[model samples]
Structures are given as C-alpha cells and as structure tokens.
Target: MVSHGFSAIRYETEVKTNGLSSVLMAKCQGCHQKFKFETSPQLLNNRNKSKHYDVNVRAVWGSMATRGGLAHLNESLATLNSPGMSQQTYTTIEQEIGNMWGEVVEEDLLKAGAEERKIAMEKGQFHEGVPCITVICDGGGVKEHTNIHTMRLEGYANSKGTLPTQHVCYKNWDESSQAMESNIILEGFLKAET
Candidate 1:
C-alpha cells in the first residue's frame, strides 16, 4: 500500500508540471470539505524530509489518525524517520495529525440530522406530526472519582435509532449545578421543532 501511494504521487508529479508542481486538493474525512495545498515534485522525491509536505501525504496522515488512533500514527512515524530527518519535521507532522483528529465536523453531523428528521416525518413515525424524540442529558464527574464534572446533552429521534441530532457538553463548577444544566439542555431541545 505504501509503495502504491508513493508511485501514485510520483506519477501525478511527472504528468503535471505546468507550474513546476502539483496542487493537491484534500478533503476532510468527516465534513468532506475540500482544502487546497501545493507541493513540489522535488519535495516528494526527497528522502531527507518527511513526505507529509505533500497534500496527498497529509490526507493519508489525517485518514490514519481518524481510523487507527494516535498510537498507530506514532508507530508509523517512528519507522519513517531517517537519520537526516529533523525533529521539527516529525513535530510538524504530529501536530497536523492531532489537528485532524481534533476536528469534530459538527456542521456535517448537523446536516445529516436534519435529513434524517425530514425522512422520519414523511414516514409518519412522529407522534401527532411532532417528532418522537428522546433528550438524554447527564452530568457526572470526570475520570470516575474526580471532582471535575460536566453536563452533556444528546437528542435522539425515534426513527434515527441510536444516532443523535445534537450533542453538547457544558462545563460545571459544582455538582449541584449539574441538574440545572441538564434541565436547560433538555428544555431547549424539547422546545425546538424537529
């Protein structure tokens, strides 16, 4: 797989040289939003630097981070390192991978929820033309026994099964306020039309 990826990138570089390099358009795995980035054929061929400078390489990095978790990324990077590779290069790649993982792509998720709700309404699964939904809100301490606690809200449509329409997390300073936060989240969801 790695060899094929390298060959594909090499082929693209060789075939396209109108402006000295190729501009690779990468998309987010979650939101499917395209982002443009440029990379040179020389950079791709260089053995001293990490190939992550290339947009294709960055997409692979993001996919790996999203699918296999960070441990796998760390292991892969360890093998890719050469004696000439600088620490800064590895740091940059790791940072990019971390950023990819950190993105929740909430916009895409919200769109999906809206579509699901529309389908459910058409099917007449809702109660009295109103959506039959579940508002699950909870708050608990962090790390099991830790004092830090946070309230979270998730809305589930009956037709949507386990999928949630929205998921929100709210910080809490005191355990007593947790119930209030949960109530607020539930009330807000209940008031909103599906």
Candidate 2:
C-alpha cells in the first residue's frame, strides 16, 4: 500500500535549452498554473538585470558562498513560513528529509535523482548543481566564446501546500544509501558549452 504522503505532482514544464539563457517553465501542481522565466548567471551578475528581475543566479547559484545543494536550498524558500532553518545545519536537514519542500518523497526522489545522474554521466550533462562557467579562448581547440553556464531553479505545482524542513544528505555516492553521494555533488555549477 502507498504511504499517506505518497502524492505525485501533476504538472508539466517547458525546458528550452536553445537560447543565450535557458527558459524555465514550472507548472504548479496545486493550481495547475504555468510559470515562465529566463535567468542566467551572466544576467544575474548583471546589475542592470536587477530592479526588474526576481532571480539572481550569481547570488544564489554562482558563488563560493553558494556551494552545495542548490535545489535543496531553493526548495527551502517554499517553506519559509516555518522556523529554525539554517545553512550550518543544512546537512542535517538533507539527511532527515531530502527536500520535502520540493514536493518529492525521499525514496522516489532518490530514484529520480539516480536516473538524472545516470543520464548526465552517460551523455555529458554534467552533474546536477555543478556551476556553469563560460570562457572565451583564442586557440588550441578553443574559440573566442564562453564555455560554461549552469543554472538551477525550483518549480511549484501551484497548489498551496506545506513543506517540511527535515532532509537527508549522503556524504558519498553509495547505491546502498538513500542520501546524496559525494560523487553526485560538485563544489561548483555545470558549464554549458557555447
């Protein structure tokens, strides 16, 4: 029998990976509404990008201070109404709940994550949460263009719901474990070839 909390998100998103910036479309599970966006680190670092943009990739995604579990971090904002959450104890939460705020069960999320990682590993998708860096080269199998760009965004199902602060994190990649393995994590973001 399925657990009481076993609920699946009924939503769809359009992830268009063919532009100067990636287009993010999140469908709300609760409201069945569509949310659209186009955010990038370059745009985030752009001072002009602010004042009008609600996202700052550099601030939330591309800094030493921005290392680790970005998806998990973003997931927290969904439950900001709660109390007693801190970065220092992030690992603790990651281990106990593993992004309950992200609208996924621990075990189900584990499998989905594994599927993503496997696909990335097999097809050079770069690991999830890796920083996307862009560089311009002059020669030697290089060109005068940026070489990387990685972005992370959390989508909602539109339905108003509650999320837990608890989480689960794995120190290393162990198929036997249900937490985020070390190999699955990188200190930076994933670079997009340009």
Best by lDDT: 1
Relative to the true structure, candidate 2 reaches a TM of 0.18
Residues 25-140 of candidate 2: C-alpha lDDT, one tens digit per residue: 76655566778766543323132332212233222333223344534444554466422224433332232232333445556756865676676666665435643322333334
**Root-mean-square deviation per candidate:** 17.1, 23.0
Off by over 4 Å in 1: 1-52, 55-81, 84-87, 97-104, 125-130, 133-194
TM-scores for every predicted model: 0.30, 0.18
Clashes of each: 0, 41
Q: What is the alpha-carbon lDDT of model 2 when measured against the actual structure? A: 0.37
lDDT of 1 by residue, 63-131 (tens): 344553233444554676611223344344545544544554555656766886787777766877665
Give the per-residue Cα lDDT of candidate 1 at 1. Answer: 21
- The alpha-carbon deviation from the true structure for residue 32 of candidate 2, after best TM-score superposition, in angstroms, is 0.9
| Model 2 spans > 4 angstroms off | 1-11, 18-20, 39-194
| Model 1 score (lDDT) | 0.45
